[model samples]
Target: MLSLCLRRRRSPQSSFATCVLPPFRPLRCETLERRHLLASVSLTPIAADDQFSTDEDSVVLGNVLTSDRLDGSVAPGLTLRVAEWNGQPVGSSPIFLPSGAILTVEEDGDFHYDPRTSADLQGLAGGESAVDTFHYTATPQFSQIYVLGDSLSDQGQLFAATAGTFPPDPPYDQGRFSNGPVWVEQAAPGLGLATTLANNFAVAGAASGTENFNESLLGTDLPGVADELDAYLDAYGPTADPQALYVIWAGTNDFFLPFSDPAPVIANAITNIVSHVGNLQARGAQHVLVMNMPDLGSTPYGLSDPVLSGQLSAISQAFNANLAATLDSSGLAITPIDVYGRLEEITDDPDAFGLTNVTEASFDGTQVVLDPSTSLFWDSVHPTQRGHELIADLVLEHLSDQGTVSIDVSGVTTVPTLDARHESGQAGELELWLSADDASINDRNGPFEYTVDWGDGEVQSVQGTAAGVSLTHSYDALPVVTPEIRVRDQDGDSSVALREVVIWGTVGSDRIRIRPDAGGVHVLTLNGETVASLDPTNVDRVVAFGLEGDDFLSAAGSEIAVEFDGGDGRDVVLGSRADDRLIGGLGSRLLELRGDADLIGSVAASRLR
Candidate 1:
């Protein structure tokens, strides 16, 4: 993965592919109104820690056949290839280069977009990597595919689309359902799709779209998969093409409650699936791929419990059965991707798919990996990269017979995707970081004139220069909102970057990030007024900032390494949780160091010691 970051490289003619918006984070918004998507802060370039830095290549930064991030439009027939920041090739796939900038994912999964060195689209424009072309009998298969489901279907899209807000960052990092690219990603090229992502609405922990009004808070944070579908339609509407495939895979979470009766769970899950599919069908989705649940009886999690395994298996079967039946009955043009049967087949004969283990989790989150090709499963529930390939092959075969369109993806140059940083605070502040290729950064081509629907009834039109812009806003009263940001350059080009923070937050409460102004000293504010001066040394941005009182609000920047600091209240601090240096603070404190490998500081040690 590229380790590039989004910072201004001082150059007289620097043509970057990213820009930043104003200071804003999470918290309240009003109705679903449109506003310019912008959030950015200039950070000083830091020296690499030697491990990541390598022999660099002269990758030119220019506008190389960029595509529309919103409409998903670019000349279809082109070769695509992307290399890591170190200039090592990831392998050739039939991807349409989307953005002009190259990005690198940090160890902590944070991203840096270096527009200085492009992904080298123009350099490789004449490469001989030919797209594997396929002849289809039906109309053009989906050029733009919209996916809605759970981790099983999620690619790095949730992170890219939602601006790394959803799934938080630490634990559920980098949107892919598996350790690497999921099945949907693996199948993109063969289906005539440029990138594996076309509006991947799938999020980790996504449910089967059967929450009540309060439960499926469409206007609020995350509700469920059905609500996800709703939001996608409301925001993006239907794909211009009728044959666009709307893929839905879910129901793993439905079986989460092992002790509860699994009957209603399965039934409700299928019902939600049916309702969501109907919504898609109504929205002109002609080709729909409905994947049933993989066999719960076979998973490592399921096999962990003998009796409970059987119960979960039964529920999974019932859910799949109902899914198949509903698709059959509703007469929707939905093809069932038999994930359950295919997964069981691989599990039964791991050698057939070149898989080794199917009954256990492999590779700890923050460590090196075991052989993924031979491992049928990445963790207990998700599949490995190889497993995703098998699923993709199965889906392709099904689509070949049932649907239409496959592309010659070789030599197709996939452009870069946009990046943003949006954070909300306790004092009704919205912090955002919006950027795209500097060449395309204008009122015509991006972060220039875009829509930021604050999920409330309010939408604003904000402006910024071509170099990049930043703006901040404070909500008077905390209002329930999911600030949906969509930035479009002059050409209506979208780097396919759109994000709506899915985490719930207090009106103005936020975990402040301490990025000292140049010399590491800045006066902090509550709401918009100055509250205190933050002057600290040796502060790291790795540790997360926690919120204080209702009135104590802090934006993401100008904060510190202290995860929890009760500045002036009767506060309870939890130590030994994350890896952070401890320091004692004001008010009555309760330091709970529940985890090990932690150092307790002075009187701060009084509570835990």
Candidate 2:
């Protein structure tokens, strides 16, 4: 949410302009000179914004032109021009900007600019002051993310070693312990790296040292964090890739080792972790991120016993304190992430993070929650995909703060540009245009493949070699839905885009139902077929119309507000616990409210009982 504003020059010949830099703790301003036309402009020490910012990891460009002209001249033959953009040359007018940003020169010598698809701007006439905005999304600076830890950061080393008999895929996505992509995989694309950029070595149930508790307890041979690091050094040698981001997040299992006294166990765990960090630093690893332990006392495993919970809580705090102090004194380029503090915040106010359950695991031995996204923990230990996403956000924020990575307004080379539109004359069909720019487009980066998550449990993928491709999908359900589209190249680099579309019901009798959870609201047919699903983060309310015949409309366990309309014939309407609006358009109607829900509706030809 921090922005850099380059105000217009005061005079026609003035070479310098006052640049209002981001209020990064101690606010200050810098003078930037337009030494030459189309020169690249660079800003240093950009800070990350607070939680209230839209994109927590990005730096934005606000109102590049605050006055009628950037050159500050109104005389004939003089016009507004862009000197530079984030250290990249603003080549020429009418040129395509990075990440789908647009810049157009109007007929009346005016300039219209749009930073990205997410930003909206109006054309400003020559000599007329206007604000133009755009966002600077980060690009990957590290070669790869080298991981070493336990199940929290594991991406299937244990599963592969166990021959896929552990942590079953039905609930654990691919090899991850969570129900979906882990934090590292989710963070990859945002950093302009492919999911494969995460060369994971973390093993499930790994302790900080060479000994794993799972090996002793379950008779399995899983390598610990120290062993994982050793394996990396054996493969790549002692001179580790300095360009890579090395991450070490372990020690939870060490606390679980059968020990009557927790003091020595906690001490050993911290010592082992700190020692391993030192090993990586000694091996030429420059960029390292170490995540501290979360409050083990708050986990379902710890909560089972009140005495154990209190003991584990104290142990976690002690371990974190020791690890932090050790890393600080070591004077290495190691960044300590406070996973304990963030986890505490989420558990303290679950609703703020769109989580309804934090006290218990979503997946018990028998079943999972109605929506795992609404839960923090997937099991007694690992977090759900949504929980991992929050962790990724935290990691990215810290990286941005430390200047290890930044928003490169230059362009996104691996991420594809996406455009979506409704197919002409096709009410239920949508067309998507996908394209990407890879440095090695003529070599290994091409034949691009596209994956579409229809948001209704239906996923489809298509591959092509063209610069741009148009793919179409049809929907059968009514109401609004947001579909996520991802494009990946042969090199494993990828980008994601999302778009919303509204589907309509048929003339025949339709049974419409809305079920909302932490992820979003799901619209379903009477036969339990999903019509559409909306993400609550991107959408606010859902509106549906049951047009004609005897219709049934309901908002059953919805956490989001909904508006339903029974267009014609006899209708049966049900409201959820959330405040909902219902309209009985024609014929006789029956309206029912669930729980203590407030209802707004027209009573004409309607019976409310």
Indicate the residue-level lDDT of 382 in model 2: 77
lDDT of 1 by residue, 264-354 (tens): 6656787888788777767665556677777766766567767546645555666666666555666655556767778777877888777
Candidate 2 weakest lDDT stretch, 10 residues: 32-41
lDDT of each residue in 242-303, candidate 2, tens digit only: 66677889888786555444456666887887788778768766667788888877987668
Prediction 1 global C-alpha lDDT: 0.47
Assess candidate 2 and give its TM-score to the true structure. Answer: 0.48
Worst 10 residues of 1 by lDDT: 34-43
RMSD of each: 36.4, 33.7
Error of 1 at 439 (Å): 53
